[model samples]
Target chain A: MMELDENKKFSKILVPIDGSESSFKAAQFAIAIAHKFKSQIICLHVIVSPQPHEYANLSGLVTPKQIDKIIFDVKKETNLWFDRIKEHQNSENNKIEILTDVILTGLTPYGEITQYAENKKINLIVIGTKGKTKLKKLLLGSTASGVITYAHCPVLVVK
Target chain B: MKEFKKILTPIDGSEHSLSAASYALELAIKFLSEIHIISILPSKIKYGDSSGYFGMVPPKYFDKYKKEAEMWFEQLKNTIKSNEFNLDKIITEVITSPLSVSSAILEYGESKNVDLIVMGTKGKTGLRRLLIGSTAQEIVTYAHCPVMVVR
Candidate 1:
């Protein structure tokens, strides 16, 4: 008979939310995993510049307020994402304690996300990919690909 | 490079571990490989003196270990016996102390030359895991073979 250890459980899971449908799906999957292991969820959102510095400089009238508005929109979307998570948890009768939402503002999305996971000692990262085609992904540099390459923790990229 | 032909899973009797085991079984079926399950006894047991009376030691500790092991083995055996899928082969091993869990697992994988290592994560964070980092993370970073960590 194969003997197994019985006391193991997942205590934490890091989830990155982008307010997209794919990210929401990833959150659903993360919630299910958390319920199964009675693990805590770290919901993170990285606020990134939609345009690069070179591009921003070219578009002269865009003020800091515009950037703040973008950040505010992302935060509002993240809160909506959490609201959906709460609804799912209540419906499923899950008892796992999820940590409060985390919002990180940075220029590099992948770097900030990876650094947060490492700093927080996150064991698993659940992320959603837009699932761009090979050429498109190469040209655009998808966040998921960057995370898979740089993240030290195990990453589950939900399509 | 050749695809993973044989895989070893170290089960810790937790639901998380069983989920990992189930995932391994599914992969084996897909890849036409074999699965080997292993359980390790902690190193503390080997260094401690056994001069005390048997009754003096906590019987529950022994019983818990035995019962958990039996349960996991039974699950694996039944899954194989049912023939629900083409698993190719299955094996199990239980090792008592004298080695740390991580080292034992690494040694077993190295000796067997398995293509992959699959295990469950404990998902610990912060100062709590400062000294003892996650086994899954360590294995993924250091293992010669690719590791698939199931949450």
Candidate 2:
């Protein structure tokens, strides 16, 4: 409807994805914005490493090898999500660059996401209202709220 | 591209809200969007209560706030005009409602089929250094369409 301007641009947009349909929707929205602005999109997924205490019950059964396997599986799954989004991008013939990052950390997902945005100097963040832990009763997910609270740049929350 | 056909931006004449307004204008210029700039005043009169509480609020209270909203709209318009952008499709309204500020904005946005809501991270009553204002938080939580919180 309008022409792009040099001053009003979202050069870099971050889309934090969890393995949820809502997050995929967010990614789609980000893709659309990227297509419009000719901006770069970074899809980040943070894997919250299970606390050591949680493994107390399965101390005998769970080993470091098992934890590695679990992390590997999670990484694989996260990659699939990236691929799915890439497929959508390709389907639309959108050539905007999409970069995917997976972070394994003990910190909360929101904390990590905000930190990454700050580190990357992200201009905008497009996130879902709810994440993998749907919590239908709560209108917004804790991670989404937390990110909104701490992010330094503008946040576009996709429903 | 997903075009934002209509964008709703609620302002309270605060510095943060002004910044959000400028951001919304930028986006609207880029998307050729019809901008709706609304100022919402929380009704001074309390509803669903006794007649005593209902009559406590002065009759001019709402009128006074409505006039204030008009001033804000004028100031915003001047600033936009100074920037030399086309304001042909821009709409400005003052909403006086018994509902909370965030609720009123959301209701109007939904009724208008607003494609995106761009608002400030804080309002006039927001505390400095606070993570986020309650009104912005509530809007982001409840709005059906995409909401952009400008800082």
Candidate 3:
């Protein structure tokens, strides 16, 4: 007596890609879910380095304009990635609109993910855990833990 | 598009769990997937009268918890019944585990080969994470399949 309601839908889905294998797997799952719901997918790429220039010796040499341009370029690169993904999804009957974002803030990956989910009213967040930043011998990354703890919406974590 | 076939949902009879069940049911209805409701009872009973006594819990000690959890599922069934979804393929399971709840969930889910996991989390404050680790975090750490943690 089960029914698959074609009317049931997801408005917005978020996936944070860190170029990790698990993150790409999460993107695959997110795209599938978004396709079923006929919703939009937002692929987020957070620059791990907030102060990229500070890491470099040219602290005073690079102006804020240069930094902004750098951020824009990163955003463009992210856009291209999402665009390719969207292109691949076109073969499927369900068309999923993809929006790409490159966040250059100092907030941790989890913090940025949760904040974006909240601000965008995302119905679901699909994230991947690389387990690289885990503290103990066996555990999730601290950032994934934080997002799972703090996000107001539902989170789908794929490892 | 990848559609879910089997969804594992753990319920604790808490508001958070109820919210999670609601969301998971929505997805299940959309996917026409079977919903498996799993409730884990603590090996040691920690009810109102027992201050901090830790001992072997009798079978009867878990009956009440099981019933309460069943009631929660009944409510969920009603919610689903009223909705357009004519689905009634619900599987209920209860386990008394000495291991942590998250560990039990991962073990059970693995045994069943569930495709997806949808559950709730009452996350502790930053300070509490330093002391008592969260079950949601542990499940996310170890679950082989995707886990949907609902607020």
Candidate 4:
């Protein structure tokens, strides 16, 4: 019984990045869509926090300070990716609005990405077909599939 | 990041596909892209036999289904006309393929060099509660071009 909503608009777009080649390709697609629609793009990078089980073996050996350092380094790397995207945008002379977010959480990457999209009221999600996962044999990465299943809005999977 | 020059949408007479069609039309207008609407009909049907013998459906049923598909295209054409879009920019076709629905759609898209694929999250046969239909999932996984799954 669903009817076409004539008011459909891609005002806000969410683009999740894992600093992989495919993710960068997805960002380019998002930029094009954003340029056409004059929409805002939210580029998010979710870093999964190390679970306690594996670190339990290290126990006292792996101090909280060490964990903080690892998280900090990952955040810095993510920032560099943001800067690269911005540089490309500037070179193109496209004035599309781009926002970057780096989140460290205990939850899964797909869960965090979908949650952020919902919280931001994003109307479109442009994601890469694959991420940094080493399983190259997989045609579709697990995270991409998971996000597609859980997202509240329309999803654009960039190859 | 290629421009959206040609957008392909596969419909199955479902409300979801209809909505997705409308969305595709809107984007097409914005990008000045050619929009192709296709409906895939299965050419092979399995009979009531344990043996793996697949044959074409009855000619009468095929004719009936073809007629229904044409009617759906006619309705969609009316919708496009009402919106005052360039009729030449819109192309509608019904394809009979031996492959699965998703595979047929993917092959058509690739052959046509489609820039983007816009499809519904689920079709008529999809369960209401499921987030995405299997066909849509397969298309997203395997298509060379970008795919937009409209909910």
Highest TM-score model number: 4
- Chain B TM-score of model 3, please? 0.81
List, in order, the clash count of every candidate structure. 7, 0, 0, 0
lDDT of 3 by residue, B1-151 (tens): 5678889998877766777777778888767788888888756543422432353447687887788878877887877665557556678888877666787788899998999998877532324344223777677778888888876
Q: Candidate 3, which segments miss by more than 4 Å at Cα?
A: A1-9, A48-62, A72-80, A131-139, B45-56, B82-88, B123-133
Per-candidate Cα RMSD to the true structure, in Å, reads: 13.2, 4.0, 5.4, 3.3
> How many residue-pair clashes does candidate 3 contain?
0
Model 3 C-alpha lDDT per residue in residues A1-159, reported as the tens digit of each score = 123234334678888876666677788888888765678888888875446556444554656676687788777767766766677678787676888888776687788888888999887888877634534454466767777777877788886
Q: A-chain TM-score per prediction?
A: 0.73, 0.86, 0.76, 0.86
lDDT of each candidate versus the true structure: 0.65, 0.84, 0.74, 0.84
Candidate 1 global TM-score: 0.47
> Quick one: best DockQ, which candidate?
4
How accurately is candidate 1 docked according to DockQ?
0.05
Model no. 3, DockQ: 0.40
- lDDT (Cα, tens digit) per residue for candidate 2, span A1-159: 122236557889999988799999888888878887789999999888776676534554556676777678888889899999999889786488999988776689999999999999898999999988878898888899998999999999988
lDDT of 2 by residue, B1-151 (tens): 4678999999998878877877787777767789999998765665722454453435587678778888877776665543556777689998766677898999999999999999999998878889799999999988989999988
How well does model 2 score by local distance difference test?
0.84
User: Poorest 10 consecutive residues of model 3 chain A by lDDT?
Assistant: A1-10
Global fold similarity of model 3 (TM-score)? 0.82
In candidate 2 chain B, where is summed lDDT lowest over 10 consecutive residues?
A: B48-57
